[model samples]
Target: MGSKQSKDKRTKEQKQLTPEAVQVTHSNQGPRTRSRHLSLVLLGVVEVPPHVWELLELQRLNLSQNCLSTLPPALGQLEHIVVLNLSGNRLTCLPKEIGRLRNLKILFANMNALTAVPEELSLCGKLEVLSLSHNLLEELPVSLNDLAFLRKLNLGSNRIAHIPLCVFSMKCLDFLHVGSNRLENIAETIQYLQNLQILIVEYNNIHALPKTLCSVTALELLNVDHNCIQALPDDLYKLSRLRKIAMHPMDTGLHIIHNPLARPLPQMLDAGLDALFRYLKDKDGNIY
Candidate 1:
């Protein structure tokens, strides 16, 4: 009987030392140690402890695969955090205080239940990658244009129908994924993305391609598959740097007419054609 009692006590003690238990303890830690960096708490839901406010020096935090329903306002106390992953959570909204993280660089919040993003997120001036895929967002804050250092943005599988013009003005943006939305048209202002290299707008309701798209001189990969596009502008052949262009099979057979006197375009066109054809063939094979 005494051995059984002792075993029960030991089991209870072991359960109390779990990471969740540790988090419960750390949450109560005072603000004195708020400057410590690198906190990870994955696979379980736990509220942010009040003690986390003391870790002002934190640079990375991963709380993925948890049942967290909301972020603590005290998260703003981590002024030095550079990478934050909160994916696979039950969060429905973000605290406005997140804007205080001026040094943050990468933010992953995919597979959440977010309905809207706070405009305060635009305040992360150093953010480079922002992933918000598989959410329920219908629109983005116009202030997102203020992210001068942003490079990659993913908004796949959302209910968004229209993109704001301000989104096209991000000068440093290189990659943009807007697949599986309800968009019927792309803003003409997209021509201003001079630095963009890859643009994926597949599986939308788009009906036509904007002629101004040719102005994106640095574009290399453009995916517009499964859309209603029936033709392409002849001027598309002018993009001397394009390497791949993915489109529906019905949109093929359109060739570029280059001015031999201006510059060489055949080499780049050949490479792009090869890549596009390969993609089409692969897609066709899957359809059968």
Candidate 2:
């Protein structure tokens, strides 16, 4: 009886931690900015209530963790919005009027049913962070590159087979995550994004990384875990800023454990970083 009770209690606790377990209403949803920042999260809202659009002063709107299947075109009325969170919903597409919010700087629409994003979204030129992970998107519109100021983009857990061509043109991008997709190889044009700091393309069909990847001198983290990679560039040391691979804050690092590595990489084992530094000196005729 005691063991059964404990198991039941643990299951109940786990359910409570998920977003769907908590029910809320628009008025009770807490907001850091009161009327200016309204968070209707975890609400069973099927549609934006007509009253929400009236809050024209809203600057940060969070409608995440809801049951919304479609957005009313009225979403464009909130021109003052700077941050918008629409994750954990059933949305198939966003209203084209989203472009009217020229001041928007951040948008999160992950864990949705979205098949595509409206091209007008590119009009939000000030956008700095955009996350659309776990969607059904196979490719993004070329207009995506118009967000010149975008610094972080997360497209993980999607069906993308190729890194969008627009991505290489984003000169200011610092963090790019395209893991858990169908990518068989990365484009050599990846070197064009000189400002890229993080490149994660794990759980794909990549056979070998391009030597030009070594030209990404600013990369600080490269995660190619669970891929078919057999060898890395002999000049990998050129990535002077690389600090770790698959080094997550939540767990101890798990780098290339599934890759059938070649030569020195396999021997590095317990001393991957140290071996990397030593290999650099041996090739460049300078000891580090």
Candidate 3:
């Protein structure tokens, strides 16, 4: 009888969970080995079963692509969870209980109906990646500054009118995506993200790129298509690592302001960043 219980425990620990399939311990049964990972995606999972909270040993949980409108507050009970994926759901707000996942490192709630994020989320001090793209968020709480390790932030396709001041403090940030929003300008404070590599602000109403933006020499990819940018900063060529620049294909009216008048943005983009850099280099106030 004890051998049979051991076999059942191994089976429960090794088997991949289906949407409706999970091994739960009965009240009459002794303790069972807790599962470390579970994925229950693409189902009408409006409510999570109470037994889920019993898995205190769970390290990763994938509840993506479900019809869940409400996340159970009991989620906080899974203190060992390091990755929580609630993407493609209908959740309008994350429960404050989420703060209990002190071990969490990655949180993805993209493609949701989230209008506001709970300040309690700031308690996840170890979070390195936070993706909340394709939501209705209009503003972010300044408390998020506590996530000192955050490396990537995806808030694209939201209704936010401006970049929050707290975002400028994320010193380790590598990628920032705020595309298809209502931003009018990027703060000069962006220069603080010295580790930044990619900056995407496409399809916004921005009229100009800040001259200070040229300080991010680590920038590799810059997308600003469909904005009203009429010129490039004279020092934009300082981003020596820039390999690609995405802009409105028809933005031929844009020009660079420097000695002897630099090339038009569209003309240089067509010529490639390499060619653009060469032009800027050769014309460094030495040539007419």
Candidate 4:
């Protein structure tokens, strides 16, 4: 009788070891190893296993280019997740519980159908790189200004009409791309980005360049093609670090081809940035 009881106990233990449960506890090992990284990129997965949230030690999660339209709120339980890539999905919104990931640093949600982002995302104080390009976002949450460490922000190919002034509060911003939008004017507050390196605002409705834009001394590359800009700010010559100017296909090297730039300025553009600056500073001031 005692021997039979021992056999029954072993059978019960084996029955509890189902495949789904094993996937969570043992990870890839026979029934006890744990996965450190979970990547499901381009698998056409429509849904994630509910037990996946149990992976508290998971550091990176890649679910890009999938068919997932929604995320399980349990995703917030991953306390150690540092990078989360959800790009190229059909998701329309993000769960507010995502704010629970205090350790998250890099988040890529580009190429999705997302219409809104949770304001709670600002809680991830450690986030540095965020890409929301090619989405349907028209406006960003006010709380986004709290991400002081954000370095790269790409909002290109969206329907954003105007950039919030709060975005300039990010002191560490190095690159900013807001091209292909409905922006009619750039705010004067743009000069607040002291560390800015590259600024691309091509294909917008802007009719003129702001004088303050030239104050960003660290700027290296500027692309303002396909806009209604009729004149170039003379103060722009003071930006010593300015390197490239892209206005139109024919206007490759500091040349103004398409825009209705007035007088000798268009002629000076043919002579280059040095010649343009000389003409602007000349006492003659003969602009026609």
Candidate 5:
């Protein structure tokens, strides 16, 4: 009985930690100036004041762990905002006006109730990182392909079944995380991600990998764990840049154990990564 009381008390404390408050910081005791770099942190804030938009100089805004069901459209008034974090919020949708933040570089809207993202978000041509993980998103807005400078994109734990072809068009993308989704197939077009360093597509229904995937010679980390993949392309060993493959305890690491791959792969994995790669490198051997 005492343990149950303790658990309840902890829950209450956790609830109290996210107070419905909005705090903004700026330079001085005088009128707001555009030269100041303002930051606002609105934790558990259920509503925002309209006057908050008057701070045109706001550069960073953190509204994480909030109870906000919606945001005031006036949020777009902060044209100079560079980083906007709206994680751990109750937001089901974001205002289209969000596209007005042209100078925005990083946007984090993960862990929300978002069902769809505004297509206008692609208008932020300068965006570098966009994370929309842990949402109800089934597909992405195609306009996002226009983000030429985008480097990192995290859409893990969503309902995405197919990787958008537009995603392969981003030449500068370095990190792509699409884990824990419903993906069935990855296109050979993935080779277009010439600059890709890390690719995570774990916990999915993928049954096969394209030989073109091995063509992404720049890949440093490739994680295709927890999928239904029956075989890996033999040329995969040609990627000398690869440093880790399925390396994690949760994933059971470099040994492709939880798969139905042909014989030598399972046997080679039992011997170690060196043996596995060597098996792929052999020209005259058959694993079947």
Candidate 6:
């Protein structure tokens, strides 16, 4: 009888050592043994296994063009993720735990159903490029001003009507796109963005230019066409680096300031003021 009991105990131990059991434990490997670099393409609604979080050294995650409705909170366990792309999904909001990714630099959350951004995202101190266009956002989180290192921000094609004055405080921002919205004012605070180069606010309801905008010395391209604007501040001509300016014709007329050394104005400008107004009105209606 004692010999029979010993044999039964051995058989039970063998059953626990099966391949399925080994897979559950993942071989008791350290975090370093798991894949540090992971890319999932065309994965449809991937159900992340609990064990996958052990790969905590991940740096980039591209889950674009998937059917994911939300991200697992376990993703925040990856402390090293730098770039995250969740575009072309149906996510309505981001998990607050996402704030744990302190090293994240680039985030693409465009083309989603997001109605609002979590204020916790401001915790990502290193974020540089953020694209939240094509969403249903009505307002931005006030905490967004805390992102000191942000450089590019795209909020096109949303319901946004006003940009908080605090955003103008981001000294590093260079490219800003807020077109195709309901905006009616050019915040005077925008003049504080000394490094701003490209500003696109076309297809809105703005009716005039802010004199303070001339302070942006680095501006190169300014597209404000398709708005109700009827005048251009004389200061606009002083932007030495500006190459392209798109606007509708002023209700008044274009007057050339006399310059002794400058050659005769280009034919486009020399065209009588009446002709110039007609040209601009036609261009604005076609381009925007």
Indicate which candidate wins on lDDT: 2
Q: Which stretches of candidate 6 lie over 4 Å from their true place?
A: 1-36, 46-52, 245-288
**TM-score between candidate 6 and the true structure:** 0.72
lDDT of each: 0.72, 0.82, 0.79, 0.78, 0.78, 0.71
lDDT of 4 by residue, 122-201 (tens): 99889999999899989889898999999988888889899866588888998888988888889888989989887778
lDDT of 3 by residue, 1-288 (tens): 999998996576334443335444333444463445778776557776667787787778888998888887899999988989999999999999999999999999999999999999999999999999999999999999888999999999999899987788889999899988999999899899899887888788888889788899888777776677776676777887764443443232222222132236557667877667666656555342
Show model 1 residue runs off by greater than 4 Å.
1-41, 244-288
- The lDDT of model 5 is 0.78
Better of 5 and 6 by lDDT: 5
Candidate 4, which segments miss by more than 4 Å at Cα? Answer: 1-35, 246-258, 281-288
The per-residue C-alpha lDDT of model 1 at residue 184 equals 89
- TM-score of every model? 0.73, 0.83, 0.81, 0.81, 0.82, 0.72
Cα lDDT tens digits, model 6, 1-288, are: 999998997676445333232221122576555433444435554454455466666677666777777778887898888888888888899988889999999999998989988888989999999999889887888888888998999988889899755478778999888878889989888888989887778778887779788778787666675677655554554455653323332321122222121222234445553444345445446432
RMSD of 1: 10.0
The clash tally of candidate 1 reads: 7
Q: Please identify model 3 stretches exceeding 4 Å from their true place.
A: 1-35, 244-263, 278-288
Task: Count residue pairs with overlapping backbones in model 5.
Answer: 0
- Give the 10-residue window scoring lowest on summed lDDT in candidate 2: 245-254
Candidate 2 lDDT: 0.82
